[model samples]
Target: MPLNKKLAEKLNKRFAPDSRLDDTYQGLDLTYITNELGEPITLFIGKRRPDGAITGERYVRTIKRVPNSDQIASSHWDLKGKVSRS
Candidate 1:
């Protein structure tokens, strides 16, 4: 065995978006929007929970400019981050 994953290596799958937006836990909302200068910025809008096992919810979005239309797309639970449950 080569002890390596060729598919992962080929695609450079080093990181993936978060997937923890289930209904079991109440979570904060996320917004990816263009700033005043037309630059994209990611924002997490909410207070962190103080509980040990409390998890937060969020979404990721990007502003794409189509030929004749500007589309704002989003994917829920796409924020990759770690929370210390301690």
Candidate 2:
């Protein structure tokens, strides 16, 4: 499901400085680490294959937060290529 605006806001506030989200799959997992604004953050975790190879490991993309309705509307448009798509 799509994340709600209120929930997004809450997450933003909760993870503002030193909090994050974690997800797991089998023996693999991902952690969204915190970082300074405009700086790149790293994601760590994933499973190794039978041959000791790893897959599905990746970094979480940094997204600049929009703190106002106008920015949020613009972001929505950018994401969907139009405001009415959602």
Best by TM-score: 2
For model 1, residues 1-86, the per-residue Cα lDDT tens digits are: 12124321322221224322211113443223334433333333344454323333232434454456544343122444543345
Alpha-carbon runs more than 4 Å astray in model 2? 1-13, 19-23, 36-40, 48-56, 67-86
- What value of lDDT does candidate 1 attain over all alpha carbons? 0.33
Using lDDT, give the best candidate's number.
2
Scored by lDDT, model 2 comes in at 0.39
What lDDT score goes with residue 16 in model 1? 27
Q: What TM-score, over all chains together, does every model reach?
A: 0.25, 0.30
Which regions of candidate 1 fall more than 4 Å away from where they truly are?
A: 1-34, 37-41, 45-59, 68-77, 83-86
lDDT (10s digit) by residue, model 2, range 1-86: 23346523333432444545564544554455565432224444455445433354444433545675313222221111111111
